[model samples]
Target: MSKQFDLSVMDGMDRREVREYVSSLLWQLRLCDGFWFLNVEKRHGRAEAEAVNGLVWDKMGDLAARDVLERFGPFADTPCGFWKAYEYLPWIPTVECAVEHDAPDAEGVIRGITVTVRRCPAQAGREKHGLEPYECREMHETEFRRFAARVSPSVQVECVQAPPDPTPPEYDCRWRFVLPVGAGGDR
Candidate 1:
């Protein structure tokens, strides 16, 4: 049996022309990397976290290997640059929830960007399914770090808070991105 693939499969945008649409598309845009992960989780449930995360890594790693980001990414391999570039991505922040960023922690002990996601759409969706929001901290740590490395190997990421942890009412998750002194990052 053969399978049929339809252009309408793409979130309702009828892609009537394949060649020109692809030619004009920015393949390394980075938004799909996030959307794919969420869609898999939504369709398969939280148990899919590990699998979806691994797949995201595989896809993202391939981008790194392709030298793809150089053509489209605005990130500069610096903490500030990562946040600035990431914040501008249109759908990710909108789909996930508005993210709040704090650059350079108050003590100045780390020159990095601290990000907060107050209302994660994924978590809300899972909760609606009567499923406990699965743990995503570890998976996201790998995914985000790999994503940053694709832009600039010097960028580092840590998930300060994620699901399965008691998310404070103010935020659902928090992440910190840093460029250590040795990595040509600000001291």
Candidate 2:
């Protein structure tokens, strides 16, 4: 018979243990990504490494979106709904982030949301390793667009600021998710 393994291995853990385990996994995931890029850059070059990274993130965005909708669907096809799903993306837990939604208008229509990254673990890691900052705007734009479009075809993602761009002192990066007028409401 074939052997099967799954998260049932964690069934016996206490809540604290589970939380710790998840935190460790997130760190491992981030480190794996960082080291992978480093090795690729070493073997090939920065341009090729970044190109491959972009492709990987693009696919990850699509997969994450599909999984989010499958696991937590029936969300409104609006900006707020997209934000709800976006919050569940794995990377969110790996970094410090804050999300602010625009107050709905009199008609209860929310048009947009602002997401700010308070601290980026990747950037911190690079700084610690004495590596230059990664210029990630293009990759992030593609990733966000793919993820948001998957959630709601009309949803639009705009980058307010990201690496390679001058960011405000308080935040590392910022993004805006918006729904066009008449898509959800004209607010």
Candidate 3:
């Protein structure tokens, strides 16, 4: 299989066609077991987005190697883009979830409990009265720990970082915690 494979073989192919082909291939490979979800994020531009969509189509055969059913992306609007590609390959069961962070901390078991809070910058004159967008900056962390305490002692807390944006350096930090899969009592 390695000898017959060429990573760059799809460079000249129309992206929509390539995506359809890959979707078909992944469906056949599923063997009626397991699920696949492709998550596409908001893209910055059309060309770069198309390139990533094409790249996903080009790399579909390698999904088994990556051990992930979902492909996260900032995809394009072409027919072979993430949404259409997923629709074409509906047999594989795809899901779209917001991509919270580039790296998620899952060092231990997950309990399925997550808490998120947004912190915003204080206006120039608001500092004197201590008025801020959020009541407590450490609220997320405190809530995470409180949720963890309710879970079984055997379960471990999984800390996942929230997405970061450079817009507000002083006030835009978000935090999340994933509880052990079944420990938190919900999906």
Best by lDDT: 2
- Assess the local accuracy of residue 18 in candidate 2 as a C-alpha lDDT between 0 and 100: 95
What lDDT score belongs to each candidate, Candidate 1 first?
Answer: 0.61, 0.82, 0.34
* Candidate 2 Cα errors over 4 Å, as ranges: 1-5, 185-187
Please give each candidate's TM-score: 0.61, 0.90, 0.22
Q: Which pairs of residues collide in model 3?
A: 41-73, 110-179, 110-180, 110-181, 111-179, 111-180, 111-181, 112-179
Regarding lDDT, does 1 or 2 come out ahead?
Answer: 2
Q: Write the per-residue lDDT of candidate 3 for residues 1-187, one digit (tens) a residue.
A: 3455675766787989788777776656542321111122133443443345445444542342122223333222211222222333433233222223223235432223332223322222234445332222233334333323322222233434432223243333434333333332211
lDDT, model 2, position 148? 78
Alpha carbon lDDT of residue 134, candidate 2?
78
Candidate 1 segments exceeding 4 Å error: 1-49, 61-68, 88-91, 96-110
Q: Compare candidates 1 and 2 on TM-score and give the better one.
A: 2
Worst 10 residues of 2 by lDDT: 1-10
Residues forming the 10-long window of minimal summed lDDT in candidate 1? 1-10
For residues 13-116, write the lDDT of model 2, one tens digit per residue.
99999999888988888889889988998899878888898999899889889888887875667777777888887688988889899888667888888999
Residue lDDT tens for model 1, 1-187: 0134455534544556554454344343444544675677678865785566766665654454234454456556677766555544332534444444445554443456677787766576657768677677766677566667656568788878887688887878988787776566433
Q: In what order do the candidates fall by lDDT, top score first?
A: 2, 1, 3
